[model samples]
Target chain A: MMDFINFYLVPGITLGAIYALGAVGVSMIFGILRFAHFAHGDLMTVGAYFGLSAVWLLGIPALAAIPIAVALTCLVALFADRAFYKPLRQLPTIYTVIASFGVALIFRSVVQLVWGTESQVYSVGFQKPIVLFDSLRIATRHIQIILATAAITLGLHWFLHHTQMGKTMRAVSDDPALASVAGLDPEKTIRWTWIIGAGLAAIAGVFVGLDTDVHTMMGWNLLLPMFAAALLGGIGKPLGAIAGGLIIGIAEEICTYPFFGESLISPSYKSAIAFVIMLLILIFRPRGLFKGRLL
Target chain B: MELSGILFYLISFLIMGGIYSVICLALNMQWGFGGLFNAGIAGFYAVGAYSAAIITSANTPNHVGGFDLPIVVGLVVAGTLSGIVGWAIARICVRLKADYLAMASIGIAEIIRLAVINEEWLTNGSLGVSRIPRPLEEFFTGRESEMVFFVFVWIIVAITFWVAHRLYKSPWGRVMRAIRDNEAAAESVGKDVQSFRTQSFVIGAIFMGVAGALSAHYFKFFSPDATEPLLITFLAWVMLIAGGSGNNKGAVAGALIIWAIWSMTEIITQQLPPDWATRSSYIRMLLIGLFLQFVLQRFRAGLFPEKAPKLNVKSHG
Candidate 1:
């Protein structure tokens, strides 16, 4: 039991944290903007790269570069909205979706152009796992992931519940026209939403990079699972995203469990597991777990 | 270029264009008429290609397929299976809006790609199935055979085009367009909007299957790499949108134009210095991204807008 918990459950939780953070950002954008931001996964990659550059140029600790990366990614998201998405705000939602695909492509291409196709690590020294029990071991990176995700999620909850801007943001997301009529500044809310959303996404990206290696394809690879987590949690519900993310993470890891029999399921099908779970959820509950808008 | 070289290039271009036209025409039915967004075009295409490849290829000891079936039988089976898959997907997701369907399709495509890669018994794993039977392979060889296959492909594409064109002008087409314009209005008029959406989606998937099978036969081989969504699925969307959705002629034209640009970019980029060659693909993608954005922003209705159906009655004013 300890071996199973250490091997599968721990990593799963860490992975879930990444997805939860990313899904929250995705859900926030979906709620406030009412369009599937397809470039979002690439935005995470951009954030990770920004973090990598910070660590490289500033000679700072990998952990310390998180704030710098988050700030920079927030600006990029803002600029992307103003330049690409804002121009087509009046168009149909499908148009925005297509534009997002284009943006995804452009972002990915820029990453490939700037970073090439090679994978990079933040700092190369390997840290031995700390033994928690006779056999159970935990990596420092995994611990960091859990701690940081908890802090951010808690901070987000507080912000949404207590802060004036957060309330205004939620109001706008619920009903932009009504919120505007009620004296909330729609543009300001939108800007702050992008900031918080992209900042969280950057943290997720940086942590994932730390857990594994930073590569141009990391975000693209994560996009499906992240979207699954978002949709499963309910498109616009932030807390639900965390729940959905954990479910997806556990399901994916469970597929590789030895009890299943090695021939029964391959680890390569982990993404498929996430997809199947989401599809099944959507088939039964189209609005997802928390009753987001059906569409 | 020499006359023979030009002829060869044109034949190759049109053959590729014909396959893409089938895919784009199918997309026109979905996005243009049905208002359904499917991001898994490549997935369905791969299914068709692999299905047909397995059915027609020579039996190998390592894999399950190798029935060596006839070309027509393979194509039919490919399209039918793909249509059935689409039906299943439509049943599950037709209620959702276009973007959700888009996301779902992406997931579906990735799953299909993964299945193809990991399931060695069916797909032969990464090695992929080879020696797909092309039409008229026995009679002609080399470029001559290719030319014959080219004509055969165009004939199929033409038939598909004619059928799609008829559908576009038919009453059913009007219902589809009606549902697309306003689902609630169509529902109020007693049309089963959901059923029509499913039908259109299945029709589109069938066409995609046919397109995939045709391309697989032409290439005489297929692997997981050929089915990348970024290359096949997104490109199909670009073709349909650029050529003008809701217009079959525009769809075909868009396929040819994009294929021309695609091939030209490849050739041009390959000629650059070695370092630049690696980067050229990214440049190509960047340009395509820009082009798609430009089209969406400026020409949402596409170059040739869907023609308003001619009303028989005269204006009473």
Candidate 2:
């Protein structure tokens, strides 16, 4: 039980938190812009890299660089929207999806050019785990990551419920035609979507970097799981995405646990867990868990 | 640089081009004719390549092999297996929106990749299946066999092209186009949109598998890396879109041009400083992405836009 708590449960929750951050963005972009936004994982990668840069230059802790990551990632997302996606708004959503794929490649290549192909840690060497209840052991960084995610998720709930822009975003996503009639600026909602989505994604990126080493493929590797979380929670529902991410992140770690003296699957096949879940969700409940729009 | 060397290189180029042509043609049937968004071409391509490698290779201990089947048998099974996979996914996603389906396809591809890399007894994992034979290896020696296989691949390409062209003109093809343009209207007109789409997807997958098998025979070896999505899926998409999506000629031409660019870029990248060697592939990827953007922006219709066949009309005199 102690082993399960220490090795499986804690890691799962930490991963879930990171995935939740990324999924929130994906779900929002899916709801508002009306495309899958394939470049979203790349946005997370950009954020993490920004955090790495800040840590290297300013000598701040990785966790302390979250604001920098969030700011820079938001800028990239906004610029990507204005330059690549805005022009194609008049066309089919598929055009935007393809362009996003291109944009994903662009972001990754630029990262590689600047950061190189090798994986780098924010600060090398391992930290000792903190013990809790004289039995459960957890890393200090993991605790920080989980707490940060929880705070952000709570802040998101507040913004969505209490703020004018957040309410307008909800209105547009829920019913674009009616929202247009109600005089909501779809473009304004779109800008906010990028801001919120990218901001959260950057935080997620930094969390992932702190947990492990930062590399070019970090975001792409996590993309399927983040997408799975978004689909699981229901599109355009940030709360649902948070729930979905926790579920997937936990499932990924727990599946590899040596239950019954045998791991359910090889650790190498961990990503496939999210893939399978996404497929099942698509086949059974294409609307997602939260009654997302069919399109 | 030398005449003989250039000739050999050209043969390899054309053979690879032919393989890509088949895959592009398959994509044309899906995206061009059927309007299915399958971002998982690598999945089907991997299925085909691995199946061919396993079926034809002689007995081996490292992985599942020893079937000792002929190259043709391997190719056929490759197509069959890939077609089945396509049918299964197409059946599941028949009612899905194109955007959603595209995302799902990427997931499916990732799943397939994981399976390939992990299932060692089946795929030999990363080491891959070796000693796979070329078609009619006993008849010709060394370089001559490459020439024979080169002819063989083009013959297959021609057959695939003919099939795609015939399907485009057929009444079934007409229904597919109708569905592609507007699905609700097609359904209203009593067309079984689901069945037609499944057929297009399966047919296209069959050719892609056959192309994958052809590549296995050409190399006389197979590995997971051979089916990289960037090389197979992304390149094929770029070719089809650059050539012209609904046009068969455009697919072939697009494959050739894009393959040429892909080949030449490697040469240019190789000339970079040794310290920059590892970064060169990323540079190539950046270039391809940029090129795709240029195509998507400037030539929405591609280099050779679709030219729908002229409808016959009789004058009333």
Candidate 3:
């Protein structure tokens, strides 16, 4: 039991936490922007690379480098919105979605151009897993991931509930027309939305980078799972995203268990599992588990 | 460049463009008339490529492929299988918002690509399935083979285009477009929007499958790489949109023009320093993205919007 918990459950939770961060951002964007924001995974890649840059340039500890990385990524997201998405705001929603694909390509290609195809680590050294219980061990990075995700998630929940800007963001998401009628500045709300969403995505990217290595394709690989979580949790509900992410992460890791028999189900099928679960959920419950808005 | 070299390049460009035009036309049918966004063309295309390869390729060691079926049979089987998959996918996903279809299709594509890679018995893993029998290979050799293939591709494209044009111009096509423009309105008028959506989706997918099979025959090789979303799916969307959705002529033209630009960019990138050259594809992708944004911002309707349907109204007292 301990071996199973250590091998699958712990790592799954860590992966879930990272996915939660991304899913929340996706949820928030869907809520406000009313599009899937397909460049989201690429934004995570940019954020991860930003964190890597901070570590390389300032030689700071990985954790210490995250704030600067998050800030820079937020700015980058804002720039992308202004440059690409803002112009097509008045067009059909599909236009924005297609435009998001283009942005995704641009961001990914830029990452490849700048970083090359080689993978990089934040602090290149192996630390032994810290024993939690009898034969149950957890990595230091995994622990950091859980704690950081918890902190950010909680922060987000508090902000959405308690703050004026957060309320405006929610209001815009709920109904832009009503929010504008209520004298809320939609532009300011959109700016805040981008900031928060991009900031969370940056943290998620950093965590994923820490857990594994920062590669150009890392975020692309995470794209389906993140969207799956977003859709599963309910598109606009951040809390739902958390649950969806954990569910997907656990399901993916669990699919590789020996119960399937060795070599019958390769670890490579983990992504397929995430998507399959998502498809089932979508098929049975189109509004998602949390009953978020149908749109 | 030598005349022969230029002619060869042009023929190759046309052949490639012809294959892509079929894909674009299918997309135009889906997005233009049906308002359904499919982000998994690459997946369906791969299914077509692999299934056709399996049926048509000669037997090989350590893999499955010995039937040596006729090319026409391979194309039909590929189309049928892909259409079935598309129908299944649409049945589940079409009930949701169009955006969800995009996500679902991407998932489907990824799953298909994954299957192609891991299911080595069929796709032959990384080695890929090769030696796909080309149509008219016996009589056509050398540059003549290229010419034959080019003409063959255009013939297929033209036939498909004509069929698509007829389908969309039909009353059934108008109903599909009506459902897209206003689902509730169409629903109130006793039209089954979901069924219509599925039919169009299936039809478009069949075209994509046929295109994939045609491409496999021409290239004589197919790997998991053939199904890259960026290369096949996204590029198809760009071509369709830029050429003008709802116009078959525009789709064909867009495919040709974009293929030309894309190939030209490749040629230009080859002259760069080795280090930079390695990253040129990424740069080209960035430019393509920028181009898409530019097109959307400046010309949202594309170069040619769908022609307004010519309604035949009789003056009846």
Candidate 4:
């Protein structure tokens, strides 16, 4: 039982932390933009590729590559906003959503064109397993993932609460027009939000790739889980997104171990677990678990 | 090239376009009329295709197959199953607003795909159930078979379009449009917004199912790979968006135009140098993406926008 718990629960929390990082980015963007940025997953993919490129080109260590990738991803986000999103700010919310789908497809196709359709593994060389309490073994990579996620989450919380720009971001999320009237530049705030969100997505993508090889489909597949977390936590609520991610991750892991010996649920269906959770939450409590304002 | 080959390609393109037209019309109904953003239409389409194929194909061990049900019955069952799934999704997600509904629908679609891929006992796993029978194998063979299949599908498409046209002008459609434009207003006006949306979604799924069944029979093969993102989901979106969003005629026209361009470009790419061919395919996808962005940017109303019928209110003196 302890062995099973260590294998399943520990790995689940690690995976959940990665998902939470992606979800926070998604939630933050949704909070600020008032539209679901479908291109977010592809953005994550782009970030992974960027990190891969940096690792390959500069011979940077895997740990060092992450921050570089994050910076580059932020730039990409800033550019994406300037190119694709800024023009559509005046359009209807639905239109922006649809346009984001277009942007997502473009990003996906571009990635495919550049990287080819083949999956590539970027080995960060962190394969050591740490012994925990003489009975449990945890991967060093997993520890990194959890620690990185916690640091980022705490940093984001602090930034949102204590900083001037963070307050402006919150104000914009609460009421864009009102925030604009109070001498806050909505466009700049939105640009910053995209940068921050996309930057975090890159971090998650790079770390996930470091833990488990880089693939073009990594970000696309992660999109649903991230959305599930964001919706589970409450749209636009960062804290909610993190908590939701952990819950989804743990639930998915637990579901893989079927109760009563009915046969283990396949890990492929782990995504379905998140979907089910999302559907139930949306049906019963559309405001999500945290009951934040609708995006 | 021989005239017969050219004719064959033309006829085949139209037939395939007919299938897409049916799918797009269903999407138009839900999205254009009812304001439901269903990103998972392909999942239902895949289900429809697989359901029909499994019912009619030869049975394999560890699963129910080789039932050899009639093609029409298979089609109906596919549509019904898709409708049921859609209804379930609607019950779970229809109450949510547009963005949330879209996300939920997409999640449901991914779940369906996952189930299909993982449930080896049911769907034969990724190997997929093959040897699906055509509707009229004995009467038609070779080119004749293709032509006959084309005509049969065109007939289905025509009927679907006519039914959709009649339904669009009906009171039900008006309520759907009202809900699409303003859910609160429609609800205040005594329409059960949820039920209406749910019913519309189910009906659309039925049409999508039928389209899938036609595709399966036409191809005579089924696979989990049939439900990939670009091929099934994004292609449908492109067709619907390129055509007029709300107009059936526009949807059909858009499918034909896009399918024709897609096929022609594919053919041309094959004739090019290997390096160029591979490069051009990516270019083509980029172009499509750009075109969608361009349309969204410039022609927000689409190629053929849905014009609201003017009410001739008599001058109040």
Docking class of 1: high
Where model 2 places Cα greater than 4 Å from the true spot, the runs are B312-317
Candidate 1: segments with Cα more than 4 A from true spot:
A260-264, B313-317
Scored against the true structure, residue A143 in model 1 reaches a CA lDDT of: 92
lDDT per residue, candidate 1, A177-290, as tens digits? 798789987778779878988998899889988999999888888889888898898877788888888888877876687874452477888788778877888888877798
Q: Which ten residues in a row have the lowest lDDT in candidate 1 chain B?
A: B303-312
State how far residue A69 of model 2 sits from its true place (Å).
1.2
- TM-score each candidate: 0.97, 0.98, 0.97, 0.96
Docking class of 2: medium
Report lDDT (Cα) of residue B23, candidate 1: 92
Candidate 2 residue pairs that clash: none
Worst ten-residue run, lDDT, model 2 chain B?
B94-103
Poorest lDDT segment (10 consecutive residues) of candidate 2 chain A: A286-295
lDDT of 3 by residue, A149-250 (tens): 888778888998899988888788777789989999878888888898899889889998899999998887888999899989887888889989998888
Ranking by DockQ: 1, 3, 2, 4
Runs of candidate 4 exceeding 4 Å displacement:
A124-126, A181-183, A258-264, B60-62, B310-317
Native contacts kept, each candidate: 0.82, 0.69, 0.77, 0.71
